[model samples]
Target: MKILVVDDEEDVKSLFEQKFRKEIRNAQFEFSFAFSGEEALTYLADHPSEVVMILSDINMPGMSGIELLKSIRKDYPAAPPQVMMITAYGDSQNHNQAMQLGADDFLTKPVNFIELKEKLLKTL
Candidate 1:
């Protein structure tokens, strides 16, 4: 599966790379990235078919994950990528907003690798 990870943190990217590089090397998966929501949308516009899933950080500089999700649902309605919103905050408001904006899942920050793995596996 091809997965896009949208986050502002370099460390987060490195973490994901650490966990999935073997899968990528073995041809089990491919990884892509975007530092901001706008960048994520641009990548999607150019490679829509190549993207199957999106794991996005909620707090971004310009556009937030919820905004990104709404845009994806609006412009790519037919085959919108499955979005998993990740945030440091675990409040009900964010969770509701994410779901209402069309996120397929919501994951709180300090993310558990095991839970994330299960979620990705199920979605894939």
Candidate 2:
């Protein structure tokens, strides 16, 4: 499955790559990384319907993840990619906002890769 990961942290790409190395090598999962929400939108526009899921961080320099979720939900209302929000803040406000904006799932950082993997598998 193709998954897009959006975060401002440059190291996140390496972290996810390292954590999912086995799945990636086995061709079970393919990942694409975007450092900002704008970049993510550009990628999606360039490759429509290619990404199956998105793992996004709520806080960023430019457009916030919530705004991204809103855009995705609006632009692809009929068949939007499954979105899972990831943030260091695990507050009710963020969670509620994400759910209200059509996020499929919510995860807190220091993300548990094991849990994320399980959830990803279930989507298949």
Q: Report the number of the highest-TM-score candidate.
A: 2
Report clash pairs, candidate 1. Answer: none
lDDT of 2: 0.95
lDDT scores for all predictions? Answer: 0.88, 0.95
Candidate 2 residues 1-124, lDDT tens each? 9999999999999999999999999999999999999999999999899999999999999899999999999888776899999999999999999999889999998999999999999997
How many residue pairs clash in all the candidates, one count each?
0, 0
Residue-by-residue lDDT tens digits, candidate 1, 38-58: 999999999977899999999
- TM-scores, all candidates, are 0.94, 0.98
